[model samples]
Target: MGAGLPAPLGPGGEAVSTYLGMPNVRPQPAHAPAHPLRWGEPFPEAAHETLANGQMRRNLAHATRTIRDKRLRVTAELPDWEALRDAGAAIKHQVMSELPALLVELERNVTARGGHVHWARDAEEANRIVTDLVRAKGADEVVKVKSMATQEIGLNEHLEAEGITATETDLAELIVQLAGDMPSHVLVPAIHRNREEIREIFAGRMADAPAGLTGEPRELAMAARAHLRAKFLTAKVAISGANLAVAETGTVAVFESEGNGRMCLTLPETLVTVMGIEKLVPTFRDVEVFAQLLPRSSTGERMNPYTTLWTGVTPGDGPQEFHLVLLDNGRTKALADEVGRQALHCIRCSACMNVCPVYEHTGGHAYGSVYPGPIGAILTPQLLGTGTKGSLPHHDATASLPFASSLCGACYEACPVKIDIPTALVHLRGRMVEAEQRRPLPTGWATAMRSAAAVMTSGSRFAVAARAAGLGRVAARGERIGRLPGPLAGWTSVRDVPAPPRQSFRQWWSQHESEER
Candidate 1:
């Protein structure tokens, strides 16, 4: 209220909240995201590290399989499941087609309803807007529901920099936050950690973890419940990400299995929802389609346990003050691509990730982005710009991501909204190749591909190359070539390549047929 003091969130501020009583220093950007989900290196390099972790592989395998079976069972119960998928995708398409007009309408409606709507072109602006709101509340601590948009913008770290603390309320997210680790899966962030590892993380890091904690699920839930209950009762502000934002009604919908999101939505005096602009659906009716599709696809539940819908502010029922930060962060640019635009239809159900062979083996960390699995491979590169090559924040991790998949089409089949992830993967790979073409010299992969193309384009050249392949006979032992020289060595690292037959199939056929002729 004083002249020199900060203005009320009339919107943006700075400082760090102490995490777990560690002297709150001024907030800094997220600890240089150098982990699997941070886009620190090429995916293969990181995947190699992850693949070497046998425990992580087993953890991912077990979790994905269990979730996959549950999803299949629930989804099969709907006789018109495909129809629901079609409806959801159609609504998303309409949203994209009318996004500009819809967004303007959303702003008007939200403003009319007494909520402040802020448009952010990128992450820094969104972070500033949120920090200012927290500052305006004169609140040092805030509780949060699991929100992908907030994570994408590094909200927690940004708040920390300004001396504000944000605590995650979702149980899995709480585990990840306590362990100081990056999320390894989409719906289940800590899926990479087994029960024992989670217990260790809780015992070692959680300030309020029970004195003697067991690796049992019930105990962990109780411990987190107690911790969040205290925070929920006292917190003045809450931050969340929306599962769907209805443009027609100016309402945001969140489908959560845990009741934490509900508490965050209702308990706080100030609620800030940071949502991706692409999350908008054309009408509230579309929710009917997605409400079913999303739960079955994401958590494998017939219906999510908690469904919360809020619009603007209410006098006494919920938060008296509300802020909505609609984030762009490169979504509009991605929408420009005809083939790639379908990637935006994702509702974060994470079905595609559950069925992906590469994701199953490598886990979410391998992709090196907040969004992991098949979706991350396509989405992260476009959001950060495929050019982020070095150690910088938002370094382009696209080059490694498109290649992360086996192109088996499982992700496409599993996608609830029919994103055609394989098509997007190929489109992005082509873009990567075209980008590489502008260089002075072709890359090794490009060179090999070109050579193969040269041989295959002409029948005579192909015949000559088929004969030349016989040179591999020298390296052959018994029925297969166990090792190869040059760049080809990587192919034989784990599996044997069959050596060219002593006589090519074409040669044997031509010899007998020529004599017959």
Candidate 2:
């Protein structure tokens, strides 16, 4: 099935290999039995523990850092990168503010081109729409292009319940699918595993996997190509996520390193695309900026290998039936936030995750959601709202995510859409501290701050407080304060609070002046 290309009839007297040019294969979706329970709980203790594995951490660190390095070098080549970023942000903000109207326009354009558009308010609706679309075609199987939105909505699992199967055709997605695991990275879904783990997964899991498959990179890719070829050629339906959808023409675009996305988009009789409403770009010209920004930021390449574009259905060619499922799924809620709302500008290049120290250490699963890294920290809290099953609302252990950065601001610099992540982190931190505080700040703390504010405002009070602080410091010696006796304990737990200086600068200056005289 993997070796021989399956020739399917297209136009008159023409046959082509639909699924990566292979025969007798079928794309089947990985089972997602536990996906429902995954909702509500932002952090699953089990997934948290899974991230502790040194092997996964090592693999992710190496891969992400390598990609980050390449991205930096390539991004430096352009002097106007910042200009492009601002434009991307501005365009996205415009879409977010006017999503409903833009979506309606998009529907009109798509429908004019013979495409059907479906609106999904949330994950369940999105899944139902896609599942029903496949069922309507009487298809038991469908092929998929790698998409974070589908993962968030658990589309594969949803289809399984309705007796439909969806198989992933991308190489990394195939590895994740065959291993019965969740994707831990955005651009590279299987980044946590090395070639050895991949070899084991294919050998152990694939029913028709060639015996004694070597761990060579080329060998593994060939194996996946063989496995997915059957699915691509035989499946009646294909599902995908679009990187950018042009509102002017209702044209959807997907950028990918591998040619698999192209194959998936074109091979099936029916095509269903689930895209976030925020993905809309005002015009085709806007693609110029993203086309340059995305590939470099994501894969560290100047240009992606395959950039696929389709406007509805083409005459007698490539997926006669086309459905666009515009997914909201809490995006509207994120949009409503004024300060935190800039998160929607994310291009999903994943440059933020690659440079993130927290992501390097904890890996993606610790966040316990589809979107991970800096973007996830802000996006997840807002999308799920404050009080999810967790006690802390946004203050779950993932709250630790905001603190994960050194406040280096590298993420903001590397961001393609110019999201101010440090600013967002600070904002989220305020929310977390407020959530953890329960009642208003205590009277004593409030009074202390007031006293400090007054002292700083008035020189006389300032001098008095400085003298008092100096006296306390002299009494305490030079030892670091591990715990504060009063309301300041939270500050001392994760940090060493330095004792006050022995003398105020004013006193020292006075003594020096007298000595000089």
Q: How close is every model to the real structure, measured as TM-score? A: 0.89, 0.79
CA lDDT, candidate 1, residue 214: 70
Candidate 2 local Cα displacement, residue 275, angstroms? 0.7
Best by TM-score: 1
- Quick one: RMSD of model 2? 7.6
lDDT of each: 0.78, 0.73
- TM-score for model 1? 0.89
- Report lDDT (Cα) of residue 348, candidate 1: 87
Tens-digit lDDT track of model 2 for 1-517: 0111112121221322211212111222234211222433345343455555766676776777677888889888989878878888888878788887888888999999999999999998999888888889998988888888898889989988988888887766777788777676777766666666666678878888898886555566667767777887898899999899988888999987666777888888999999988899888888888888888888777777678999988989898989999988888887877878888888888889888877787777667677887888778777766542243334354555555456778788888988999999898778765665564544444456556788899988888878876655543437566666566676776687677766568989999999999
lDDT of 1 by residue, 407-452 (tens): 9999888888889999898888888777776667666656777889
Candidate 2 overall lDDT versus native? 0.73
> Which candidate leads the pack in lDDT?
1
